[model samples]
Target: MTDAITPHPFAFPDAALEDLRDRLSRTRWPDRETVDDWSQGAPLARMQGLIDYWRDAYDWHAAEARLNALDPSTTRIDGLDIHFLHLRSPEPDAVPLVLTHGWPGSVFEFMQAAPLLADPRAHGGDPRDAFHVVIPSLPGFGLTEKPTETGWTPERTAHAWVELMRRLGYDRFVAQGGDWGYAITNELGGIGAPAVQAVHFNMFPVFETMEAVDAQEERALKRLRDFKENESGYQIEQTQSPQTIGYGLNDSPVGLAAWFYEKYEQWTDHGGDPESLLSRDEMLDNITLYWLTATATSSARIYWQSMANWQEREIEVPVGFTLFPRDIHETSERWVKERYPTLVHYNEAPKGGHFAAWEQPESFTEEVRASFRHTRQPL
Candidate 1:
């Protein structure tokens, strides 16, 4: 294993682009959905529109340039090469922050937010709101090396993150995440990670055990039940047979795009059109990363590795929750407090959804800033 943290510039090769284009062009599309809407999944016409844009308009070179501008790097941690973007703030007393990305998302989700968080002054914010940001692609995702062994659960990833920060010479830091990122950040809080001062989650992972449900809680429970019943087929397959499905996803570009695009549509708050929230290029950028990395199987293995039980776990450090209104379910403050007794901050944004930072970076940034302000250094 190499000890040096080498500077790594992202360059998607020409051959890969050609192969992707060829696959997209020669896509053997399926019959259109029986319904006219996205209830059955992403409609054939919608997917075709995406394919057209991806093939004719999307520019990988421009995306690569944007990525390259970030000063990304890779370092070996636990025998795996972890790729991360480290952006230092101009503020002399800027707090260190490590942001983790989850499934169906990558470090790219935070691309727009990175500069704002790192150098708020440049983006019309006070210097005191600055953070020295570190965005690491999780194991088996994006540029990070896929683990060969079977022990890369959220718990393990939390430990690896601590080491990653320690190696970067940060003895203290805060963590932020949503979706699977939220799970890992919660795990860090659970284990009392030595360097993690406090943690924030947009998608709070608190499950309520209610014997009596009120109107609001009833609605939330209904949404949870709906998710379990209708929207979790992908989870079942990924958790059960990730390698089997990986074959199709790794082999077919359209299949991969549709699979991810469907989630972006359903999971995001875009009035049934994900494109309304995130640009096609942004969506394809993430999907293309998953495709180019051939991480379909490796990334899905995380679900298989950590799908045992959804037992409640205690988080030790101060916790903050940014409640996005259109997220999967709405858990009340009472339910959240049950799990996070140290809950210091809670606010529900009028806009945004599951991918809060990506869809509404400004609101998400403010929530993060307010969430950790009390814990910031020089307090």
Candidate 2:
């Protein structure tokens, strides 16, 4: 495969949009949940409303235009066409930074934050905080070429990211991520890539058993336990049998919408309603990308390939972390320090959850600027 970073702008076929609308119109919905709240999964009414809006009001063309505005491109890395958005900062002294999106997420997650980070001065922040931002869709996700073969785990993805960065002329750079983005970033720092001078995570996955020495740690452990017991059914199914579920997710737009809408409801930091924080269009922007790409099964396979093999390992590079309160799992600063000895930065965001960047772009942007302030240098 050629190492060609081709300009791959968004231009979805009209027939694809027609098919999506037709599929939405003909969705075979299931019966309503017995419970009123989200305990049983996305409520039938909630999903119906969403699907109604998706079919009637949502504009895929508008979303397509937004994606194209990010300067989208693709390159063959490891025999796959990896789609990514690359934005060079106007500031000459800007530091190169790569942001990796997680499952149920696309480059759409960073649409707001990427611009803020790349042009801090334009956003009323210091020019010194500017970053040459690169947001890559994970292999088998979004517009990226789906892997036909197995073995594309997070570790392998991390290596591909390093190569992608190197090919982009970033001999030295910083990394930031959350969710599976956190997993991939963790691996990036652990693998001793000299080019990765520092790494940052909004979600630090700490699985090691340690006694809680205080109330905060105790609460964090309780949340972790709760996530494992109640909130991880999707993880179990995806890790064990992604292909089985892929059939439904790929075929039905409603199925795909409900699958991701559940997480937007359960994971975001909002009152009872996720719509209070995230607009319907914003949520659909990401969900529609998944539907258009037909990556439901392929994206799920990442969990199958990576989760069982996860191990606790020290990340030697300097690290930064911003823990959002409403996330699925919480880790005490002590736990973070244990894993990242050279901890350069850590903070608790006032708001946001699993989709931190999307939920609170301003806060997410500020955190990234602060986290890498110490690592910035002329590239």
Candidate 3:
């Protein structure tokens, strides 16, 4: 058997990428609007600048080559073809950590931190903290199987990932995630998987009810409501009418980039310009993943499957939760403690945005490692 059964490392062919560059160069741009602010979505002017750079300067081959240099390999667990970066530390006792990414994110999230985690001495960290990292492209998200059937919710994804780690010979390992990762990591531990010693997450959902509201929770509730009303239009579109909006995203490369540009622009603590935080090259690499795999529509299916008559799951695993300020309004500590009684460690990060894994990898990794240092492995 050939590796063709599963997506191999840096599977993107050069010819297809060249086609994308050519298409981007020939973008049928819309009429220039005389606007200084982005009251609408992606500003035509800014995106044009990015597009120009993307076409003229940004090299997909170079970016893809750098990604290829990371050494991606494939494995099988429970009849699913799992694509992952299985970077091992030099130390024999290195703790294996399984990382999962969310929608609009890929295994690329760990690209920067791979070397450091596998060899901390080179990065100024103690070797004692060295780790063997396994970053997987979730089924239907990245290079993993984009199942044509339904039932790939957070819970199911977590279950499959747990099996993935166990199959890798990690009888006891740590699990960490952000975004949809937060939801799934909770479930990963909740299922009482004996292999998963501890779970860490950057985006945790503290249960909320119409009945409970203190002064602080009340204010956060107001902010959440305000954010939803003003800034969550994209999510509403994604959650409700993904199929309808899929045409624009799937049809044109520019349209697809613009849609994602809006997210990077708004979600990031970008100081104003999306390009400031994410350069044209960095952003497009992620977009290119969707483009090459044609997984954009399939990725949206997670929202439809989960939120469409979706019910929440109960988490009973020992958890390490880090609540970022900009992350969906802070759940009252009282609420978190009450809801997640099994939570062993909780930290409130003063700085970070939704893309915690990318925005603050050092902080995110340190917190996750420290939180699970005393991982309570079950017999």
The TM-scores, one per candidate, come to 0.96, 0.97, 0.90
TM-score of 1: 0.96
Ranking of predictions according to lDDT: 2, 1, 3
- For residue 320, model 2's alpha carbon misses the true position, in angstroms, by 0.5
Candidate 2: stretches off by over 4 Å = none
Give the per-residue lDDT of model 3 (tens digit) for 1-379.
2223233777577788788788887888998666778776777888898788767787777767766675576666556677777777886667888888886788777777677776787788877777788888887766777777877778877777776666666767788887777767777777764667677777755333533558867766776776677777767777887777777777678888888887777666667676776677788888878778777777777777776554545667677778766665556667677767877888887676677767667877677767876663221
Per-residue accuracy of model 2 over 148-252 as CA lDDT, tens digit each = 998888888889999898889998888998888988888888875478888889997755387788998888888888888888889999999999999999998
Question: Model 1: residues >4 Å from true position, as ranges?
Answer: 206-208, 211-213, 310-312
Best by TM-score: 2
Better of 2 and 3 by TM-score: 2
Error of 1 at 1 (Å): 6.0
